[model samples]
Target: MKKATMTKMHPRCNEHGHTVPIKQPSKASLAQAWADPQGIATAVPDSAMPETINDVPVSAWQGAPTDAAGWEALVAGLSFTEPPVPSAPGKKPAAGVVTIEPDGRVWVVAPTNAFGGYRHTFPKGKLDGLSPRASAIKEAFEESGLQVELTGYLCDSVRSTSVTRYYTARRIGGSPAAMGWESQVVMLVPISELRGITSHPNDAPILKALPAKAIVIYEWGLASGHRVLDTLAGHFTRYGEWPTRIAIPTGMHEGLREEILSPYGWRLLTERLKVVATDAGALCAYGARGQEHSYDTNGPVDLRKRASEWIWNVDLT
Candidate 1:
């Protein structure tokens, strides 16, 4: 029963029934375990893929899988992609919102009602069951009232009856005084003008559940605003992204110079890593979106002079 009470074990029974024990879960559970999606689309195993992304025609990889474990299981199933392909058989879970402004235009929405006063759409909806990733974040703040923050996941189409999901939120907080009532005809289109708007011919189920190219990766068990010393319980790793350290930022390093980046799963393959930041800014995440950072390290020391305070390396094959 040592090791600092062993992070807290669990197994209970009590009342003389002989088994008592409980009290440790201070927090951190999130919980999720209920997938079925028609047995993951028939678990297609036949491989020989390469159907696109620079010469993949030949009628587009018929039964994909030519070798290397069926092309690394068709590139790890397109780099771990799944969910949203159920547009027909009993569909429901909906929610949309690509919203990417700052002069980038990616807020395509569809679905209107009124004609002269309210007839626009695309800040979609229809998810309350709880998790189409939390209903694409409550249907993008209930159809563009604002209040967004997801920063990831922009797929899930499901074809026919309606499976939507398309998220990539950003706004940050409710605005336009907080919209609702189906967003009174929301607008905001750009991803290349969204083909002249008024879409929804079923918008090709969010452009065939988008994903032709996008990839980025890098992460390390983080959370050290400054006085870090959790005893390296997680001992996070992946440290080599783009080396050549500290030419700046000192003390609690003004807050881990954030610039999160996630492309993981499409951009084919890329790497240019080199990290070393502490004093609270020592993280240079990538894929799961944590882009580039340098926590100006000043403690956990040891890595050489700059104590690894800065110096990452990644050649990405």
Candidate 2:
């Protein structure tokens, strides 16, 4: 019998800058890793990573740290000027990226010695004459050594010194071993463990904006008038979070629609309803006469067309 040969893997660094062999995780192991509180942590090359790249300080934000007092002082000082000309009144515009892997793990960076009061945080920096999207892409690569493609805008975070725009992204290429000096260590954390790892108040809103295992609710008139509210309330009660997306019928009363969803902070979408309806893993449809059909299949374009009423897509792991 012939034996299968395993491919040799590359060595990466740990938090202490010690070189260690790392192997690619299997699907089963990746799922297990996501559940485990101690997610994957890898360190970048300390000696190789440069302190300054292209005349920009690798440790970037030299203003106050992210503490409450520091943040207040930073904001107050912005109103005053040194050379008789005051700087911009508001926070500096910055951009960052939050990269998530296919297996549902988030990539975070550990700033060197908790610089700018961030021990573990997402990669972000000042715009530096670049657009928000472009700056986010640049910062993600520079801090984590990972090439990422921006998928959607996440949220705008008002930090101690900057108002940073964050974008959701997926990893394309690159390795953590190539991370710049700004990040002492690179970590691949699960969404569940994100809050625990990052304790700064500035990161709370960004974490809240992250997508979760949600049931996208779609309703016309029947479900909207009867079961939609119950379904949304039940989901919120059970999971402590609202559904990802909700689609309403064309003729539903505008005031009623707003009253039902606005209180829960669900943004109603009319123009992009079809686009949201099609991009789901599973869907449940409600007929015009209250007939119902639930589907646990992917790519349900045909089912969507045949259904007379609204459709709900539940993300199946």
Candidate 3:
């Protein structure tokens, strides 16, 4: 089978002032561009692309060898560790891909109306003698009709029949209109709506594994600290986890260290929490209960406004 060609290349300048082809758009830039109607043209599309190149599926027709040694060689440079949650006993190993488009939308597959108890989910299947990376690539094409290149490991989620390792990927070629018989439809969904659309109980861990687009940072106070903590706790209870990203002032870190790190499993929260040093004048003193305060620094102000979702500050005097 003939291999599918990669998407058209665009030129970009590097630090050394040499012009080089930019392989993929950064997630941040994609998110920003998605907001503008003109930016829709910037997104990669499969307009003239073929569903299959020769007899093989376009997604799996990479020019590289499909053997075990070949797959191992391809992933040798990638750095990823096993997830903290171990595979379930007596379950098989599987792999999946979460393909994000250039316009910042995520690809999800509808499994022929709840097939295998899945209404909508990421494309995935058993390893079937292939490496996790290879299996994920093949499964993505068969289930979602998208050729994906794995960028990074997201996490491993233990499901009813398998311990599936999920990876973050970007669409490189192929078209969703060519989805296989297993899938009824393929959809590109916004990140904010992913949690609501892919609402299977087993998918909670996978959803949590996705990186947050923005984090909320606030000053801590004797009275307001507890209120913020209560708000965070409530969010956790409703969402099944704390915000993926959080930041606090350095001075307050010591005072709230145990409360923030102990009960929720330090291993999980440590990576998400950031203790930053703030200038004395950067933050205003707390005002009235349930009141909001704005940041004095332009950086924080810009971050709050630019974030796609979830940004707020609480202050009390």
List candidate 3 stretches off by more than 4 Å: 1-76, 80-85, 213-317
Pairwise TM-score winner, candidates 1 and 2: 2
Quality of model 2 by C-alpha lDDT: 0.52
Assess every candidate by TM-score: 0.23, 0.48, 0.49
Query: Which candidate would rank higher by TM-score, 2 or 3?
Result: 3
Cα error, residue 209 of model 2, in Å, equals 0.2
Write model 1 residue lDDT over 1-317, tens digit each, in one string.
55555433222222254432223222211111002111101100111222221121212113422333432332232222335445466787676656444322344322223322323445655654454545554565544444445555556656455677665544544332233333332334434445555454555545433322111122222343212211111122334332232222244233333321232221111222323344442442332234323333322322221212222112111
Each candidate: what lDDT? 0.36, 0.52, 0.53
Best by TM-score: 3
Off by over 4 Å in 2: 1-38, 46-88, 212-317
Per-residue alpha-carbon lDDT of candidate 2 for residues 95-170, written as tens digits (9 for 90 to 100):
8888866445678888755778887899999877666666777788778877666655567777778888887776
TM accuracy, model 2: 0.48
Clashing pairs for predicted structure model 3, backbone only: 286-316, 287-316, 287-317
Better of 2 and 3 by lDDT: 3
Candidate 3 lDDT, tens digit per residue, 165-201? 8877767676665565566556666555778789998
Q: How far in Å is the alpha carbon of 210 misplaced in model 2?
A: 0.9
